[model samples]
Target: MATSESGSDQTSSALSDSFRTPYYCEENVYFLCKKLSASGTAAADGSDLFVVFISNEKKQTPLWNQKASKRADGVVLWDYHAICVQRKKEGDTPLLVWDLDSSLPYPSPLTSYVSETFQPSFQLFSEYQRFYRIVHAPIFLRYFASDRRHMKDSAGNWTAEPPKYEPIVAEDGAVHNLNEYNEIHAADVMTNAGDFLNAVFTQRLGAVINENQLEEFFLKMP
Candidate 1:
């Protein structure tokens, strides 16, 4: 994945375009970020930058129509969405997240973004479930752990020595190796100038999200 050393917006957009496809966000964050960074290093604070993919526990609202909700036993379905997160070093500076589709301020502080994005329906027992993986790009790429990736802390960040690509189980129980997976799908996600904005409008992919939904989500925040 090639990127230009331009402004942050361009850089971010470039990065997102390179990652927006169905599974690239997950794979690239674990494998590509550090290699692609202009400086072959971590941030000054020693905290690693990360790319986070998130979604409600359901298949994406399909382009044509929403899918009927269904779940068996312990199965969890995932839709598609990705963002950039940078851990704060310390001091008063806040930990922030960057999402291209968000109406909130770009690079939103984590506390505020979390409070606004997840709103419970009931005060007593309402809890929305979310699953995430955070890869510590620098350490994982440099000094890897013995496991494919190891949990280093409660924040869900992972660290591990880069693995030699091998057949791994996918969400649907299919076997795939990262190398083949990227070869097939990477081009599908890579975008040229203006391609992303066009996809946003034409595909109705939540590029222009509903302000009312955001307002309602926040209004219910406590």
Candidate 2:
């Protein structure tokens, strides 16, 4: 499969109209996002008893270059996006993830030869536009762990470096997605997590969020 740079779906639509119907997105591509997001509610179903779409965008076509995006077969494909979904709720967090299935394997663009030479790398919460939107509230962005370095002064045992991803009462405390992830342990820590996130948001994001919407978003999170 030939992958594009930006991976937008605009090119794909043009292909369908110019060509025939019943075309397919490259491997691991989908268009389910329009089911709920087109209206803007972004309502998702968590009770289906499978991988949850923690993060995702409509499936898109890869961009071949700056001005134009075409397919490896020269079909001019379009419509592409990343998605982060998982079976475990704890896995949802500030980190970036793959679309649909966590193991969907990115960089795996539709190629003309259909050979797996280059693979894409992406996570759910961190990186690109996902990071920007996750920090904003009115939506639940579950963060597992992001940091690993912790200090255990006079105390004993392995303590979670950053805390706040947990479900206990919180005040300026939450989790954040880590772009540089080596192990899952870093984002799994709690306690100081929520408070830490509050600080980051206030200091960096300013006041683009409404506390009520943020709280309500989390409240509905499972």
Candidate 3:
């Protein structure tokens, strides 16, 4: 991994150039997962690619080390954010997190990413607490669709420029279903750890987990 500051900056810049847009984190992560799947770095079937959605009931998620923040601390309150996590079957390799908007290393180790980005040790109001929804990348890539409607103002002005590329459509031809992935509720969180893990890998919407459970849940993945 790129441990030096300069090396990390270069790697992050290159990844941003390849897969990032101004405000389309979901699409950025979608393409990232697609590339990882095609690279055959995960299982041959790409079963190890996971997409993580971060937000809370109030849509206020405070993440540190984001490129979008002007604060000296690099903390940003995003309505929602998306990132890709890849788990290698090899026991010696740590899981990796690919976040286009993060100022962290291009592919930070899952533990480091969770610690620095989520800052679980930092206390916050209930509304500012973060929740996560983890989806199997293969299933997400097949069913995730977006038309960029979420970026518009009430009068239909673009909040930010849409990606130069065409909007993403699901394999089944569905479009504009972005809310299904972004809207995570605490009620949806699974109480049983086994059920949560199973749903995360097998269910369409996957499972919702709280910030405290994020690291543990992903670490438990095989």
Candidate 4:
């Protein structure tokens, strides 16, 4: 459920879906949470890599209440048209946006590619093969931003440019056919996020994926 807090330096208040949107920039750590806090994770307030977001609680529904992605009902998609326009100004790569509905457990979109719960070894392949859905979780976006740094539009002018994307259907029936988007997934981002937390809070199961391991994994992707 969304809340109304007085605006702060880290927040950007605006209109979205006809209601006020409260975007909070929080530390990346806020993305981490104990197993109990499903809908109410911590915000980036001031201490860590500030992650920014708006709570969509004004309406009594899941943040992804609009409708599920037809191809991947498991995919809570976000249309980042506005962010695309803005990114063109900063020469930043446009982002893909969507919030996950943890209320349900989604089947792994990559189940067909290989049969293993995500593990360190799974990182060794083209990103397309390793990650689920339309795109790989974070590396794709990071590369996108990197690519946009010096992008030039069709005008032959290097004005801050937006990316161009063509959606294609994956074997999982998920679609990857857009640009300027963001997906906040419980399955991809937090499902494993919780794995890390579980290791920290309770008994460790699998070896945790370190940043270097992740880097090697994604970098190995073509």
lDDT of 2 by residue, 1-222 (tens): 121323434442332233221221111222222222232222354211111111113222332221122434222223322232222233223122223221223222223112221112322232211111122221222232222223234565434232323322112353332222211122222234355346324332211222123222333434
**Counted clashes in each candidate structure:** 4, 57, 0, 18
Error of 1 at 100 (Å): 5.8
In lDDT terms, which candidate is top? 3
Q: Can you give the TM-score per candidate against the true fold?
A: 0.37, 0.19, 0.91, 0.19
Candidate 2's TM-score: 0.19
- Candidate 1 lDDT over residue span 1-222, tens digit each: 221222365555565455332323344454335433543333642334554444322423111111212322212232544455555444353356554444445445665665544433313221223333232444333322222222134675543333345423444343333322112122233223244334322331212222123323223222
The digit string of per-residue lDDT tens for model 4 on 2-112 reads: 312222312211111212122210111122211102322122121111112221112111122222334432233222201100001111221212122221211112221
Tens digit of lDDT per residue, candidate 3, span 1-222?
353222345544555577678789999988877665665544656688889999888998899999999998789999999998878666554588888888887777888888889887899998788889999998998889999999999999999999889999889899888898889888887778999988977788899988778778877665
Pick the winner on lDDT between candidates 3 and 4: 3
* Candidate with best TM-score: 3
Candidate lDDT scores, in order, read 0.37, 0.25, 0.82, 0.23
Question: Which segments of model 4 are wrong by more than 4 Å?
Answer: 1-45, 49-68, 76-222
Look at candidate 1 and give me any clashing residue pairs.
144-160, 144-161, 145-160, 145-161
Model 1 earns a TM-score of 0.37
**Alpha-carbon RMSD to native, per candidate:** 17.2, 18.8, 2.8, 17.4
Model 2 misplacement above 4 A: 1-82, 87-132, 135-222
